[model samples]
Target: MRALTGHPLRPVTEMSPQRVLLVNLACMGAPALLIIQGVLQHGKVDWFAAGLGCITLFALVALRMFDLVSQVHDKARQLDAVAHIDALTALPNRRAWDLELSRRIAAARRHGSPVVVAILDLDHFKKYNDEHGHQGGDNLLSSAAAAWRGQLRPEDLLARYGGEEFGAIFDQSKLADADRIIERLQAVNPLGQTFSAGAAQWNGSETAEELLARADVALYAAKAAGRNRVYVSSIR
Candidate 1:
C-alpha cells in the first residue's frame, strides 16, 4: 500500500512492536470514542454498539500480537541464513560445511552410500593478492564460487573453508565422478586463474574428520606435484 505522500508503505516485517502498538491505538480511538459517548449520555447505554467496539479493540490487539510473532519468525530466518553464508563468495561458510558433513555422514553410514569430500585451493593465490590487492582476491573467490556452483547439482554443497580454500561434499558419488567434478571446477576461470583440488571418497569406515584430513593430505600432494590439477585419494 502507498502512504498519503505516495511512498510505498513499510512492510509489517520492518515495523517494530512500538510502531504496531501506535497503529492499533489509532484504530482503537474510534471505538473508544463511541464507548465514552455511550457512558456519558444519561443512563441509556447502547449495549450492542459497546460490545462491537470492544470486539474491534480486541481484534486490533490480536492482529498486533500476530504481527509481533511474524517479526520473530522473520528474525530467525535471517539469522539462519547469516550463520551459514560466506559474505564474500555467497557460498556456504565453513560452519555450514561442518554441519552438513556430520548430517550426511550419518545418513551415508545408515544407507551404505559413498560420499566424496574435497578441498580446493586457489593456485598462486598469494601472488594474485600481491599483484592485485585484497579486494581483487575477494572478487576472484566470488567469481570462482558462482561459476562452480552453477555447475553443481542441487544436493551438492560447496563451502568456503578459509582464505583461498574451499570445501565440497558430494553425496552418492564415486571417486571417478568426484574427480570429474573437481576437474571441471579447476577449469572454471576466476579471472583467468586456476585452482588445485584434492578429492577423497569416504570409505564408510572413517569419521568426517578423517575424510577431510585425507583430502587435505591429497591436496598437499597436488600442490607438491604441480598446481592446477586434481589429485584423487582412494581411501576406501
Candidate 2:
C-alpha cells in the first residue's frame, strides 16, 4: 500500500478537477451499491462499511475543494499581471509605475538614498505615427523599449507611462548620474528616432506626485526649448 501510494497515485493528483471528481463518483458509487445490496439481502445496515464509505467521500470532497482554491489563486495572479503590464511594449504599465514610484520613494525616505524620476517622450511621435502606419509605430515602440531596457541597470525600473512616453526610476542615483544614463538611452534610440527627457532627484521632502510633477515640468521645458534634449528640473 505504501509503494502504490507513493508511485501510482502521484499522477492521479495531477489530473484535472473534473476527472478527479468523476473518479471519486465512480469509487463512491461502487461502495454505495454494495452497501445497499447488503442492506436488502440481510434486512440490516452494515455500520462499519457505511462509516468507511463516508470517510472516503469526505476525503474526495476535500480534495475537490482544494483544487478549486488553487485554480482561483492562479486566475488571480493572471489578472494581476494583466493589470500591471503593458500589452504592447511588454513593460510595466502606468498603474504599475505609480505603485513602484511610491514604494521606491518610501524606501528612499527610510534609507536616505537618492532616487531620480524621469519622464521621456519621443520627439515628434505624432508625425512619425502619421508617416508610418500604426503597426510601424508599434514595432518602433517595442524595439525602443527593448533597447533602452538593455542600457539600464537591473535595479532601475522603466515603465510605459502612456503613448510614446516612458517613465523611469533610478535607484540611489543623483540627477547628474541619471542624466548620463538617459544619454546612453538616447545614443541607442531605435529606428533613427530621438527622445527628450526630464529628470528630478528626490529632495528629501517631497511626495511622489510632487517629484513627478517637477520631472514633468522639466520634460515640457525640453519639448519647448527644442526636442531631443535632456532637462534636469531646477526644483531642488
Candidate 3:
C-alpha cells in the first residue's frame, strides 16, 4: 500500500515508535501479568496460551486500524489533487489559480513585496482545434504547459486558468522582470504556437480581483491590436 500511494504510513498514524510501544504494552500488560501469575501460582500452560492469543488479537486489530487510517489519508490527498489540478494539461486549475492569487496578494500587502499577474490566451486556439482534432489541441495544451513551466522560476506559479488560457503570478518580482519571463515563455511555446499576454503590477491597495481585471483588460487590448504580443496594463 505504501508503494502504491507513495506516502509513508507514519504520518497518518501520527504516533512515534515509543508511543506505539507504550500503547501496545498498555493493552497487553494486564493479560501478560495475569498469565504470569497463573503460571506461577497454578503452573497451567493453558492460561498462558489463552493470554498470548488475546494479546495477538489485540495487536492485529491495532495494525488493521492503522492501515485503514493510512488508506483514508492517501485517498484524501488524491481527491485534493484531482480537485485543484487540470486533468488535460496537468497544471493547476482555475480554482487553484484564484486561491493562489489571493494568497500572493495578501502576502504582498503584509510584506510590502511586489506581485505581478498575467493572463495569456493562445492565439487562434479554436481555429487550431478545428483544423486539428480536439485530441491534438489537448496534446498541444499539455506540451505548451510543460514547456512554459520549465521556463519559469520555481517560485513563480503558472496555472491553467481555463480553456486555452493560462494565468501566472510572479511573487516578489518587478513588473519588468515578470514581463521578460513571459516573453521567454512565449518563445518556448510548442508547435510554433503563439499566445498574447497582459500583465499588471499590484497597486498595493487593490484586491486580487481588481488586479486580475486590469490584466484582463490589457489582454483584450492586445487581442484587438494583434493576437501575438504582450501588453502591460497602465498603472492606475
Q: lDDT of all the models against the reference?
A: 0.84, 0.88, 0.87
Residue pairs in clash, model 1: none
lDDT of 3 by residue, 106-139 (tens): 9999999999999999999999999999998998
Report the CA-based lDDT of candidate 1 relative to the real structure: 0.84
Alpha-carbon RMSD to native, per candidate: 5.6, 7.1, 6.9
TM-score of 1: 0.82
| Candidate 1 regions with alpha-carbon error over 4 angstroms | 1-45
Off by over 4 Å in 2: 1-44
- lDDT per residue for candidate 1 within 1-236, as digits (tens), equals 01122332235555679977888687777677676776798656677776787788778779878877876666666667778888888788899899999999999999999899999999999999989999888889989999999878878899999999999999889889888887777667669998888889888889999999999999999999988888889776
Q: Which residue pairs overlap in candidate 2's backbone?
A: none
- Candidate rank order under TM-score: 2, 1, 3
| lDDT (Cα, tens digit) per residue for candidate 2, span 57-118 | 77877887797677666556666777888889989999999999999999999999999999
Candidate 1, after superposition: displacement of residue 44 in Å?
Answer: 6.2
Q: What TM-score should be assigned to candidate 3?
A: 0.80
Off by over 4 Å in 3: 1-47
